[model samples]
Target chain A: MNKCHITNEIRKFRFLQSEMTQQELAEKVGVTRQTIVAIENEKYSPTLELAFKIARIFNASLEDVFTYNA
Target chain B: MYRKEKMILASLLATIAVFAVYSLYVYQHYVVPKPEIIHDFSFWGKSFLFLALVMVAAQIIVHIVFAIINKIVTKKDIPVISDEMDKIIELKSLRVSHLIFAGGTFLAIGSQAFGIQQWIMFAKLFSSGFIVTILSDITRISLYRKGL
Candidate 1:
């Protein structure tokens, strides 16, 4: 539980997408901007539902948004 | 940002403040001797009365705040402090709090056994308990934010 489980490529995606703001993504995905910030910082693992929502927003698969590193 | 948490924090602060003020009143006016005419049994009675009042007042304030916050943020059912992630964080914090509490309590016992000042030992226990509780509360909030 203390270990950081999920890793992601969100930073690369944000850069690829015209340096998109976290709040814009969060608003599209129906979550608070802080949630997006937390995800980007790796300080939080998005819920399964939020994970899917993010992948959808990025037009990518779940593995594109998040993955279990260990 | 959630109303319920703000409400609860406010209640905790209010309760602690009210009791603290009442304690100040007792200590200043009644417990110690002063130059003027001494206070009477009423002060003793009042102290006891306010102690009870403090407890009751704290409980009532907590409930009232919860109710108001609930109504104000009616769309969100209950607070956001509880969830699978928060539950995990709470469990971790409780473990840390328990360890500190036990260790501090043991140190107090050891000091008394070695004949260090008893008042100091008591103070150690009191202070550690306060620290542990505050630490636990903070950990819970941090977990809520960080989703650990």
Candidate 2:
């Protein structure tokens, strides 16, 4: 939580995917939509399972969705 | 299940449980068809039977509702609970219950050591114990939800 990290591009991916609702993605990925929002805002970090889920949904590598600042 | 949906379902089940207990009380007291064995039954023993029934009914209802909802909502079966974050929060909540259990037992002993005249009766002791565990669990859950 302390180390710097760039937030997820989930919102952008979500928008690109014909405006997928948070709830829809949450259902697909098996997490609460609130968790999706938290990850987007960088307020919370997703578990490895969820991070992989997001990457899968976006059809991108983990690096595409997330990055470390330092 | 979605967390919010789980919460709503839990709240509904809790409300139903209270109603079920009240219904049983009324039936056992004034509204029942007739007492099976009127004079021979111990009142406390009858109450204990009703309490057990309520507990069993509540458990059944919770499972039934969760199963039904999950079936209706999705083809994929999601656990009522999921994942490590949830497990951690649940474990923390359970810890509060243990703390309250220990504290209440200690307090009861302390009162006896002070030479209090009356014993903590079974009903009072049971109610106190129940309240401590449940209150602690609920408060702890709320704290965890709020990021404590």
Q: Which number leads on DockQ? A: 1
Residues B1-148 of candidate 2 have per-residue lDDT tens digits of 3444465447455645664666467557743665443323254356546665765677577767766776787764544446444555567767777777777767766677777633343334445555654565466446434432
Model 2: residues with Cα > 4 Å off, grouped in runs: A1-7, A32-34, A37-44, A60-70, B1-53, B62-81, B117-124, B140-148
lDDT of each structure?
Answer: 0.68, 0.62
Cα lDDT of model 1 by residue, B1-148, tens digit: 5443455466556556765777677667755655222235344456556666676777687777677667776754443334434455669889989999999999988897787866556547655765675677666666656556
TM-score of each: 0.55, 0.58
**Highest-TM-score candidate:** 2
Give Cα distance to truth, residue A33, candidate 2, Å: 4.1
Candidate 1: regions farther than 4 A off: A1-5, A8-41, A46-65, B3-8, B11-19, B22-60, B73-81
In candidate 2, list every pair of residues with a backbone clash: none
Task: Give one digit per residue, the lDDT tens place, for model 1 in A1-70.
Answer: 3666898888788778898788688667776665566678787887898789888877889997798988
